[model samples]
Each structure stands twice: as C-alpha cells, then as structure tokens.
Target: MIGPATPEGTLFEGRVHHMSIERLLAFSGGPFTLNHWPARNLHIDPEKAAEAGFPAPVASGLQAQGHIIRLLIDLLGDAWSRTGSFHSRFRRPVFAGDSIQAKARLAARRAEAGVTQYTFDVWCERHDGEIAVVGTAACTVHEPNPGVQAA
Candidate 1:
C-alpha cells in the first residue's frame, strides 16, 4: 500500500518472497554453490532439509530479514531505510523452497519535532501457517531526499 489513506493507524501487508536456492544465492551477491551456504558449513543434512520441504540448504535468518527490510524500504521510501532498525524473533526455521510473506500493521503514529513517527507490528509467515519471525519496528519519516523525489 502507499501512504496512509486512513488517519494514523494505517496497515499494510506485503506479498510473499518465494524462497529458492537460486534466489538465496542471488541475495548472497553471486551464484553460490551449496558448499558455500551457511547450512552446509553447519553440517546440515540434505535429507533432513528435504524432509523439512527444502530442496537444498536454507538461507540464513539474517538473509530473510534483509529481504523483508528491502521490501519495506521499497514501500516506505528512504525514510524507513535510513533510520529504521528491525529486530525479530525467529519462531520457526524457514526452509528453502518455502514461500513466505512479510506483513506489517501500523500500531501507532505520532508527530514529534515535525517528524512523523510510525510504529508497526511486522512479521513473516511461512506458507505452512508457521510464523517464522515477528517483531515491532518504528520509523521516522523525514523530508524527501534531495537526489530523488517521489513521483
């Protein structure tokens, strides 16, 4: 969703980021081999991962967090990205090949020193009805960046 159409307590739910070995590697900055993935180094068993519905080793929790953060930044613009800090509790393991969705509901909004501060309850849920991560995040929207303006 775009800016808050409703007053202060607006909410937004984002689309899912489908997980895959290739997608994980791309997020890692290259086409990484299975041997290079963190799960490999941790001695994660391929058979066990397969039973967990993963085709191969899963991406790290931090990697998934980065994906969600990027998604939020894209929606909220530079304000949230520049000043926001996201912390989450990993409730369940997100395996490779599992589709996950990042959702945020505005918990509160207030004005302070001319800045609009917004708080949200954010979470990522697996397709299997498991919540992989949940947390509260807050961001302050500042004046638009000089380099780029929102169209």
Candidate 2:
C-alpha cells in the first residue's frame, strides 16, 4: 500500500512489469501467425512485422499506458484510483522484447476541499534509453479512513 502523500519535488520510479511475447500475443487475442493472418502486428512473427516496417512485433500503446498508470498507482495507491487522471502520448513503439521503466517527479501539490491534489510529470523509458511515452498525471490525496484498520 502507498504511504503518506509524497512531498513536492520527490522522484518516484519503477521497473517494467514484464510483458513477454506470449503475454503480448495473449493480450492481442490468442495465437496466430502473420501467414495465418490474425490482426496486424498482433503476432510475434518478425517477417510480418518487417513487412509492416517494424523490426519486430510491437506492444500495444495501451499496454504502455497501463504500465504508466500502474506506476502511478504504486506510488499513490487509492489516491490514484479514486481521483487520478492521466494524459499520455506515445512517442515511440515499444517492441515485445524491450524492458520499460516508469518515472515521475512530483511537480506540485495543493490542498482544497479536504483533499491534497498532486501533479506529476511522468514518462516511461525503454531499456535502450528512449522515452517511449510521456504524460502528466494528477491525483488527489484524501484523508485515511479511520474506521478501516490496516492489515
């Protein structure tokens, strides 16, 4: 679970939640080759990807977005779930074999109407040091529930 609200200017980062070739394929809807003709770029076949101009099968942009959101959730917990908002742009394709890392720097915080709202500059970088996605996220910090005890 997430702890107290992070101070402004704090940096938070996390490694990729691995998405293997099998997992990517599964996420795109079960097994098939480019020859068998499943959805475009959904299979792991390199030849098909090369035909499509990518060196290999690329992971879906949604998957990369999910990773970014997961990073925010890891840092802010329910604050993110209940009030967080994200806007992201995919700058580059993330291939199936690449590892990803998410990082965020808290840019600002303010208290209003019983909640502390936070703004963060967030990005996900590929293992090769290229930023694959970039965005801003906002989450509101609410008071802990006194009636619910921690486990």
Candidate 3:
C-alpha cells in the first residue's frame, strides 16, 4: 500500500499529491470577495449568476488554486511557502455545490550545486472527471536536507 506523502519521501518524478473540495464543502467567498463584498455577486448569489447567464454562482479561480497550494504544502512542507511559484488557467466554471479535486504530479526534479528544483503538473478535476483548472507549479530550495534528495 502507498504511504502518506512527506518532505522526507524524497520527492521524485511521477509522485502524486492531492487535495479536495467535497460537494459538501463548496463555499461562496462572500465578504472576502471585495468586488461584490457582502452583496450579491456571481460567486455568492445564484440569482446574480443567472443575470450574467450562468445557472449558478461560480467559485473563484483562486479558490481552486488555494486547494492546489494546500496539496503542495502537505507534500513539500515549508519549502513550498518560501520558494514555490504557480501559474494557472481556469478551464471550466467551478459552480457552487460541485465536488472537485486538486491534483499534482511531480514532473521534474533536479539538483545542482546547493539548489534543488522541483516542478509539478497540476490540475483541478470536477466530480464528473472534467478538468476545471490546469497549471504548472515549481519550487526551488537552497541546501535542502541531505535525506530529501529525489528518488
């Protein structure tokens, strides 16, 4: 059986990491969504979404990004916060009440001098298996733990 991922796992090419937003956990940013803060918007009000042509409120793209970041942190620990960079494109609308999963596969890992660089192909998949977001993320570490070399 596979074990939980940890920084000590020697992050290797092809390893996978993930996080999820269950159907029960989907949320509207609401007050935090300053554009429509505390008021009706495409993200917090279904009626507003209909006005704009969508059937229901859509979650922010950044929310999906947040889940991907959480997966990275779980897999890479603090190294992700200090040196990670991410770029993403929203492919399909993530509507309210949808269940989605943010997944990452380590696509590259290299070490030279005192630096170790890691890259991942990341995506968010809707419950029905359609991709909702896609991106690449990378992190660089200086003088990483000797035990953490890529396997």
Best by TM-score: 2
The top-ranked prediction according to lDDT is 2
Off by over 4 Å in 1: 1-9, 28-39, 42-56, 143-151
Worst 10 residues of 2 by lDDT: 142-151
Off by over 4 Å in 2: 1-5, 30-47, 145-151
Superposed by TM-score, candidate 2 places the C-alpha of residue 32 at a distance from the truth, in angstroms, of 12
Q: Candidate 2 residues 26-51, lDDT tens each?
A: 66744564465355453466677788
- Per-residue lDDT of model 1, residues 1-151, tens digit only: 4343335555565677888766664654333555654443211446655776766666667766765676567556777757787779878777668888877777776665556676778788789988888888877775332322321
TM-score of each: 0.72, 0.78, 0.72
Whole-model lDDT values for every prediction: 0.65, 0.74, 0.66
Q: Distance from true position, residue 27, model 2, in Å?
A: 2.0
Clashes of each: 0, 0, 0
**Tens digit per residue, CA lDDT, model 3, 52-118:** 9998777777776777887777656667778889999989987777777777777776777867787
